[model samples]
Target: MPCIPRLSAPHFLSIALAAASFGAAAQQPQLSAVDLARKNACMACHGLVHKQVGPGFAQIAERYRGDAAAPARLADKIRNGSVGTWGRVIMPRQSLVSEADAQVLARWVLAQPQQQQPPAR
Candidate 1:
């Protein structure tokens, strides 16, 4: 059998540094399909966690939770940006997003976990 080489202190430190760097990178959340859509300027109106000129992403998730048909309904709404649910906030329809993009975005959005704010003290 071949003898195993021992690692020196500096070699061990380098290994630790490399592992730490990789761990930090892995801890970051990946951009979802919808995130790309948002970065493409879809969020000029709609927001991720809070309400802006448009309804909040959390609000949409809440409104459609458990609805089997919400994906289709939301996809249509995004494609057209029609108003009525949240009120007169006209959702200026997006022609920039494609049908596939709409579907991917809808699924990613609907799949997001809901976050609640703490009661104001």
Candidate 2:
């Protein structure tokens, strides 16, 4: 006969609580720059508000604020980098994103207002 270890009531409750906490955290939409940067590999080539190999999110946001279609367009440009946009340091097209991911990034970028915003006229 094999002896099996049983979980105590306290142990089970702790596990349940941990699981519930994780579930709640997951349910909360990660509409944050930290989350976006960590999830999308932004740190690989770009910093939060500084210049890395590429421009930062703040620069992008400041450049495209108040334009409704700007988010969609920026997302598309991220997936497909352009020339002469930021000097000759061309950003290569990222092949690891979906439209949904792009939208998330775009929304996150647009949400940041730490820098200057475009004219409201």
Candidate 3:
């Protein structure tokens, strides 16, 4: 006969607590950036990873890596519109998207993971 080990009370309590925490987290609303982007139609031109009409958020992050002022600059670009920076595609001025929202979106983009290029020999 195979013997089965019984879980201790402390172990069971910890498991229950972890499950509850996970459930709570799962019930929380989507990240603010995602919600804002969805509400403003930003996803129509930009994606988290792959390129849409504009460069991917990750690519933007990579391009501005190590720049301390990137967030502020990106926020300005979001509001004022930019062209010739990423080909002939023109980013129309987002007058509807508030400055605060633009800042939040820029921060979110900067937080995304950048693709690491392999080191050259």
Candidate 4:
């Protein structure tokens, strides 16, 4: 028969606390940017990797990669929609999404990785 080592009370308490902490973290909202976008119907016009009615998220990230004010600027643009940037396509003002949520979404978009280019042959 194999003898199992019994854990000390402190060790058990620590393990239980760690697991409980992880459970709390898991309970916290972990929705991704894409999920938020979808929930707010932004996916109707934009996409993560490809263009639909508007430019894709990756393209937007590439366009604003160097600008330090991209997050704030994009957040404003989201709250108050504009035209002529991508084309004549009109982005209606997003009144339903809260300003804080708009900023969160904008930050998420800005944090997206730029599209990778193919290596030279």
Maximum-TM-score candidate: 4
**Clash number for each model:** 0, 0, 0, 0
User: Could you tell which candidate, 2 or 4, scores higher by lDDT?
Assistant: 4
TM per candidate comes to: 0.65, 0.62, 0.69, 0.70
lDDT of 2 by residue, 2-58 (tens): 998899999999999999999999898745646755776877888778789888878
Candidate 4, residues 49-108: lDDT per residue as tens digits? 678999988889989888999998898889899899998988889988788889989998
**What is the alpha-carbon lDDT of model 1 when measured against the actual structure?**
0.80
Of 3 and 4, the candidate ahead on TM-score is: 4
lDDT of 4 at 112: 82
- Displacement of residue 103 (Cα, Å) in model 4 is 0.4
Candidate 3 per-residue C-alpha lDDT over 3-116 given as tens digits, one digit per residue, 9 for 90 to 100: 988999999999999999999998986459989988988889998877899989898988898899999999999999999888998988998988898999999888888687
In candidate 1, what are the lDDT values of residues 1-121, reduced to their tens digit?
A: 9999999999999999999999999898756786766666767877887788887777888778999999988888778778878888887787777777777778777876788678999
Order the candidate numbers by lDDT, best to worst: 3, 4, 1, 2
RMSD of 4: 10.2
Q: Quick one: how many clashes does candidate 3 have?
A: 0
* Model 2 CA lDDT for position 112: 69
